[model samples]
Target: MADIADPRAVEVSRSATGALASLSLAMLLSSLSTSIANVALPTLSEAFSASFPAVQWVVLAYLLAITALIVSVGRLGDLVGRRLLLVAGLALFSAASLAAAVAPTLPLLIAARAAQGLGAAVMMALTIAFVGDTVAKERTGSAMGLLGTMSAIGTALGPSLGGVLIASFGWRSIFLVNAALGIAAMLAARRFLPPGEAGQDRGATRENARFDMLGTVLLALTLAAYALAMTLARGRFGGLNVALLGMAVLGAGLFLHAEGKIASPLVKPALFRDPVLAPSLAMNALVSTVMMATLVVGPFFLSRALGLSEALVGAVLSIGPVVSALCGVVAGRIVDRWGASAMVAAGLALMAVGCAALAVLPALCGVAGYAAAIVILTPGYQLFQAANNTAVTADVGKGQRGVVSGVLSLSRNLGLITGTAAMGAVFAFAVGTKDIAGAAPEAVAGGMRFTFAVAAGLVVAAVAIAAAGGLRKRRSA
Candidate 1:
């Protein structure tokens, strides 16, 4: 029980812990959408008679909207109130999930997914920023560990749950489940969480808190153009390939210019100048790229090569996150004893082992082979992911928490996109064909091998970066 002697301290603790629980639930719902549809993707493709490129859009659209809107929304939360943004996001997300479940056409599904992504952006941006706002500095590591644990559990369960739903009922069940969860979360948030604190300021200014609309527009264009180029590069757009490449570059340049000169930038350029933050952000991007690539590509291998069912495939894939989540608790304790840098480095080392094991999984004979590999890798991934978040936030002041959270979110999204695009291309190339439209079984296996190897290589690179650039927090003299 918290001490009631000091009313101000007690109030802050009660409010913050209550907010944390609500936000964790909201975050769980958001994460459910992230990987929940992964298992159902192939099923949806078969139902819609959609091309591979088109089906990829189902995943791409959600992530794209999240990437574009996360920074802006986080900034909005800081300017206004996290509680207000969180409740609103929950409402919007629920409505979008309902629409997604009943979507008739591919385009409608994509639009609904985008709306869901917007809701996700709101939830992710606010929850992370709220952690920095609500909790005292000394307890920050523990709060992050708990939050990270929730994320790992949500992500780990998402695919298996989606697989089970699709197997028994239908794909629509995934979205319906999200809607139910969202409604419950919304009610909880409204009942317990505080209202907008924008009017009560400790020197913060809402008068100058207009959203950087132009910066937001430019950033969206930049991300869209990049997606377009990646899609074209994969030979999706037959004739307009060169045009897509040009558009991507032009959009990138415009976004840079907008962010550089704008007073209220979509992404504050000044944050990048922080020696501690920049490398940590870059490390997150690289690390995420590796994790997402494995998630995206590894399953294809399991289903294609090992002949695993969707349910079994999701279960097998989840082993790593389960291990990672458990290890995150241990890592949090370790971070308290040592420093974030040690845990981060150790986590990356574990990830390297996992990636290597994944690459060589086919060589092993039975269930033990796969399990052994997962044991080596998953805990590492979870530990590093949590450590990175805690490390990044610890160094920044309270006022800059929202922007930092947004930047981390943006970095993560970009990494996932880049990893999927680049590695998807690499896998296609390994199979030695532009169109994997209907690849042979053996060729698919070979492609999977290539993808896993590439993922492993990326993690190894990340480990190097972490070792070379990762620095421990300094003790007070």
Candidate 2:
């Protein structure tokens, strides 16, 4: 390592701080865009005179685009340069937001949203990797924690902010706001960030520099087919759904086989073979699935089963996010001191307890009980995410940071899709009604309890896996 007292090191450290701020702001904006558009779905449906199912594509299309392209773009970042990719992503996101704000038809708006998702995938996949490249190794946990805090703040603010903007200035204002933020972030990044990685310029000259075009197409098709199949199977299962599912499996198999043989694979198989990396990724996916399932199912339970008004439901749900934000700051410090593995185990344990409370307490205490349970659950999620992210990134080498970040992002998207589909099916089966609105209050309550219990089981399994991995590590040591 270079001399610690060097003047250039000091200047670089100061610049890294500014770069971190820009990255954090971009993360917040990207997450805010995800949740903000959700509140406008009903308004858009009315304005476009579209059916509920059709208008739902506004959200689905964005998610699909992000999930499909994140890995491929991340690999590109490693080959070209993360700084260049990030700046381009910000510009694209800004342009897409402007396009969305002025769209004359629902289809145009949907297309713009998909474009926004593509930009978001680029920004998100590279942000953490950039931190790894720019910041000192010792301070990595603190920087990652701050990024997590910004994400929580965005998620917390989105719905309330969306509602206020829609009431005052209409739905277009949301996209307009995003456009402004994106432009500001882009300018800040260009001014503050250091030049691209040193070897990036030589990447084009390497004999193995060819991009994994086939692997990218196959992965995109695989995710799209699976997502569509799940959406189609929601209310009714039929031959088309079966065929789509088969197509998804075939696509996945081909992608994996192709990746294994490629000189420069989009996703290197060796990453999964690392003992530390493998378990961390698995826990990330499982924890995310449980977190998202609660988010989707909790509103249905509160609004339908308990007959709570929208305002009351929103207020109750807000408690968890607020707690999570506060906890995220503390969790980051803890990761630096106590280490990531311990925090992850402890956080998962808290989540399991909260899920158990939700499963059993609602019947006895009603709205107050559900609120109390979430109070436990949300902070746990925040802690686990911050710690787990730090752990997974720390284990990867600098050269492969981009691809590893992509894998983590992909795992999260898969978890979200899986949780929504799996929990929804269980809820429908428990209620004995295809239409949640038409189900009896008792049936809805039963469904909620069953879903929460299943979520608890998933968490317990994750906890067991974490414990086993810890044991194996100790024995090896």
Candidate 3:
């Protein structure tokens, strides 16, 4: 096949830097939006005179919307123009942020949040895809690495920033601030990004474009069902949970079957058939599971078991992302030198060791030990994320980058839901109480050990997968 990259694509030296900065800002904005509302949940609940569970939907709605729509929107970007979709998404996100800021009721706020999620899904799907589209192949690692750094910084800053904003201005200010940031990013994108190329293929046109609507619906159903099932499972597993799981499985099976038969499937079946892409994706999923599990469980362990304040727990939790941001630029450069597979294996090994340390050291060493464990864990995760992202796209074709990016996003989301549901279940069961206030310290400690061990085991499995994938790629080469 002839190169599908735009003939008019700007040289890396000419415009790549500004383009990267714009994309990074978009990434930071989207990532920050994901977690910023978390800190304001209590405030929102109080302001609206709503129950906690109902207010929880404010977060859940955004997540579910993003997860469900990302794949479809990504494929759409490939059919249409990524730049056009990106700008549209940013506009929508900004408008939704405004709507959310002025929402008079909890329901309206949740609806606006969902709208923001839809826009975020578009931006998330294309941010990395655009990197591949715009930057030189040789420098893709560096671009991806910096992108990861922005994500880390955004995630790490969300809670702390939200807390400060809420303290000073109130919960509405959070969405208002997002709106301003979104507008700035949108403007930056417009100024820096190249005109969208619908597709590099000569035959690409709206008349010829055939979106796999059935596959899109099936995929969306699969993700939504699974996400809902996991969310419900976090509370309790029952008949409805069983039904949702069954539906998810059915939807997944149908999606696969449809993809295999369809001409232009949302996710290309051949991509998964490739040894590198498949294993890279699996590794990404596993690593995300470990990361999210720690994020969900760590603060609880510190607060309940060690009697740490919320501020102290936030500081402890911030350690990983802070370290990730610090290491991301360097890690990207290292990936350029050493290749992604080696770095990924090393990263997984480091994560395993860190998780192991958390599993054992917390009981003996206490809060300081927990902090030390995170110090070890964060760098490994940052390294793994950068390398794994590079690895997934290394062999992907230009035309397929959007869907591939979507798959990567999907993997991370699945991992997030899985880690939260599975690890939360184990922790709750181990502690013998869902209510942390009543849980005994010994029980909480035991739960923490078990959870970390499980996380470590997951990382070990990821290491094996990475090794096997690397060997396979070497043989193929």
Clashing pairs in 2: none
Q: Estimate the overall C-alpha local distance difference test score of candidate 2.
A: 0.85
Highest lDDT model number: 3
Give the alpha carbon lDDT tens digit for every residue of 1-477 in model 2.
875788987788778888998999888988899889999999999989998888888888888888889888888888878889989999999999999999999999999999999999988898888878777777777777788888878888999999999999999999999999999999989988776672232323477866789999999999888878877657676898789889999998999899899787777777777777788778888888888767777888888989999898888888777777777777787778888889889889989999999998887899889988988888777778877888888857655777778888888778877777777888788888889987888999999889888999999989988898889899989
What alpha-carbon RMSD in Å does predicted model 3 have with respect to the real structure?
A: 4.4
TM-score of candidate 1 versus the correct structure, residues matched by position: 0.84
Off by over 4 Å in 2: 1-13, 198-205
- Of models 1 and 3, which has the larger lDDT? 3
Worst window of 10 by summed lDDT in candidate 1: 468-477
lDDT of 1 by residue, 87-205 (tens): 89999999999999999998999899999999989988877777666666666666667777777878888877998899998989999999999988888888767674642222335
Q: Higher-TM-score candidate among 1 and 3?
A: 3
The TM-score, computed over Cα atoms with residue i paired to residue i, of candidate 3 is 0.94
Q: Give residue 46's lDDT in candidate 3 (0 to 100).
A: 98
**Residue 39: error of model 3 in Å?**
1.2
